[model samples]
Target: MTEVLLEAQSLKKHFPVTAGFILARTVSSIKAVDGVSFIIRQGETLSLVGESGCGKTTTAKMILLLEDPTMGSILFRGKDLQRLTPAEMKEYRASVQAVFQDPWSSLNPRLRVGSIIGEPLVVNRALPSKAIQEQVRELLLQVGLRPDHDDLYPHEFSGGQRQRIAIARALSLKPALIVLDEPVSALDVSIRAQIMNLLKDLQHQYGLGYLLIAHNLATVRYMSHRVAVMYLGKIVETAQTKQLFSHPQHPYTRALISAALRSRPDTQDEEIVLPGEVPSPLDPPPGCSFHPRCSNALPLCSKTTPVPREQERGHWVACHLAETLTVATRATISAEERP
Candidate 1:
């Protein structure tokens, strides 16, 4: 069995709304990440997939310790992050890194690529000036960029090149875990594949664990070892990539897969369009938050929130009808397989 590198137990992040000028009375809160829990095994990639505003980004931020959790705990290698002191937190920062969505916005426009990548070493005072330059050059080459290209500014590089520079910088400290928040979403489709391949190669080479937060199911399918599907502010389903794709028990997961299947021009499948827009987090639906949009919703689904339960080996789903759905799905697959 693989050792767990990072574990989140009911991790929650809520943003408070304030009203009034002088008193600043607190209004309702927006529960961005409400009770999310998962474990990332060492050298494995866990992809969190969902629609926009579904708390994927919020969860990523919490893992990076950028956004403090409103409730619950984050344990990295059995050490609770909230217990770290100011200086210890600084050291912790060096062990975790992030690659944001937009390469253009993340990179410093004025600084040369070498300086940007070397900044982490300078901040930690880890190496001499000459060594910093050498390390930066080596990192650039590792990410498939020419070592000499390090002297060029961000504007001189293309979008893919800029993202490579960003990735090289993130790897400068040799972090154990990386939180990739839609790392390839902003790039061109052609360029996306190259970055994905690079990420895969890097993970194999370094034994790095990753928390990949993205809305693209296709991309998630290609890169993830395991996948967690989120809706509103909660995780609705989680399973190994092949298991989730083959037998998605949750209604939301089924819809997402249907959508992905429909995207292919050769597919003659019907799309599963959910009714109504996502409800506001501040005023989430009572009982099951997803009941309003779920196609197979029942009376109990609206009156009682379903907790995640194991439906099969290593597969967990949060839904009142998951067992029934699993049987129905198997019957359907059996029918399709008939000659």
Candidate 2:
């Protein structure tokens, strides 16, 4: 079995909604990440997929320690992050890194590529200048960038190159886990594949665990070992990539897959369009939050929240009708989705 690098148990993040600027009071709370739980094992990619504002980003933020969770715990190799000593906290910081959506904003415009890449080393390691420069060059080479490009400013590089630079910086600290928040979404279509391939190669080389946050199903399909589909601050479904793509059990999961499949060439699958807008997090609907948009929602769905069940081996679904839906969706899928 692979080593578990990080684990999150029932993580939740709620933002307070205040009213009356003069005498502000807590009006309500926006449950951004109501209760998310998953684990990333060595060299494995676990993707968290959802529509915008579904709390995937907030979940990522909690993992990165950028925002404190309102409830629940984050553990790094069975150690609770909140209880870490100062030295352990520093070590944790060095072990974890992030690659954000936009490379243009992520990179420092004024700094040369070398400085940007080597900054982590300078902060975390007491290495000499020459050693740091050598390390920077090697990282650039590893990412398919020329060694001499390090002296150039960010503006001189194209978007793809900048993203590669951002990746190099993320790799600088030799992190055990990297949270990729839509890392390739902002790149050109052609460049996206190259970056994704590079990331895959790096993961193999370093045995690095990845927590990928992405909206592109194509990218997710190519990169992830397992995927967790989030809906209204909760994970509605989770399974191995091939299993989820081939046999999604929840209504929302099936809908997402059907939509993605419809876009492929010669695909005849109909898109599942949900009704109504996503309800406000501040005032989420009762029971199953997705019930308002679910076409096959039962009366039980509106009155009682469903507990997540292991509907199949390694496949979990949170829905009142997952069992019935499983039988209905057992038809053969496209060859592309086969394990």
Candidate 3:
């Protein structure tokens, strides 16, 4: 197996809810990320997928160390994140970079593309201005942009072009892992494939690990080596890209797959629509948080929480009816098309 680049073990982040403004006392906690675990290895992409308020972004935040976990820990290259010293923390930041969802907002509009791309190198390494500009030019070329484009401002570039600039900025640090929080979700449909293909090619070239947070299952299927289905702040299922889509075991996972496949004209399976909105994190349902929305929830599902069971090779499910769940008859999604 490839070396593990980052590992999250039973990670949980709960934000305290305040009741009063006058010396606010903690009323309750919103379980934003409750008991989520996964590993990202070198040269692999692991995507976390779910609907809004499902804790996908929160999980990413915990992994990125933007929010400290209340219950669990994050280990990067075998070093505990929460325990990292000042020097170690700086190293960690350099080793792991991020590309946000909105490239336009991420980039500084006042700065030129060259300065934006080279900012990290200047900040971290304090490289000479001439060297930084040369490196920036090379990065621009790597991302399918003309070197001369660096002279222009952020407003001059199109959405896709701005995203390329954002990507180049992320690449400046030469990080081992990149947290791509909906990297292409903001781009046009025609440009998504280009960005996805660029990301894949970059990973192949550099053996970079990606922790992708995206709601678009098609993008997840195409860019990810493995997929972890999350629901209501917990992971419901995790499996290889092909296996998860074709043989989803958990009801929530199945529903998510069904919804994703609904858009494909060739998909024979109907969308497994769940009833009701996702439960609030402040007061989630007992046992399985997804039980209230699960269409095929068993009586036991509402009474007892299920532990993650390894159903097959590397495939895991946390559901009451996992053993009885059958493989999907629908065709496997093909992700061979690339620019």
**How many pairs of residues in model 1 come into backbone collision?**
0
Model 3 residue pairs with clashes: none
lDDT (Cα, tens digit) per residue for candidate 1, span 58-138: 998888877889999988788888887888788778878999999989998989888999999999866789999999989
**Candidate 1 vs candidate 3, TM-score winner:** 1
lDDT per residue (tens digit) for residues 1-339 in model 3: 789999999999889999888989998999888999999999999999999999999888877778888987889988888788998888888988899999879999899898999888988887789999999999999999999998999999899999989889989889999999999999999999999999999999999999999999989999999999998889999999999988888888878777775565775866677788887888999988888887767889889999999999999999877875543232223332332
Give per-residue CA lDDT, model 2, range 1-339, as digits (tens): 988999999999999999998899998999999999898999999999988889999999998999999999999989999999999999999999999999989998889999999999999999999999999999999999999999999999988999999999999999999999999999999998899999999999999999999988889999999999999899999999999998788888877877665455776776787777778888889999999889998888898988889988889999989888666655444344688
Query: Is candidate 2 or 3 superior in lDDT?
Result: 2
**TM per prediction:** 0.96, 0.96, 0.94
Clashing pairs in 2: none
The TM-score, computed over Cα atoms with residue i paired to residue i, of candidate 2 is 0.96
| Candidate 2 deviant stretches above 4 angstroms | 261-263, 330-339
Best by TM-score: 1
TM-score preference between candidates 1 and 2, better one: 1
lDDT, candidate 3, residue 173? 87
Q: What is the lDDT of residue 100 in candidate 3?
A: 95
Off by over 4 Å in 1: 85-87, 261-263
Best by lDDT: 2
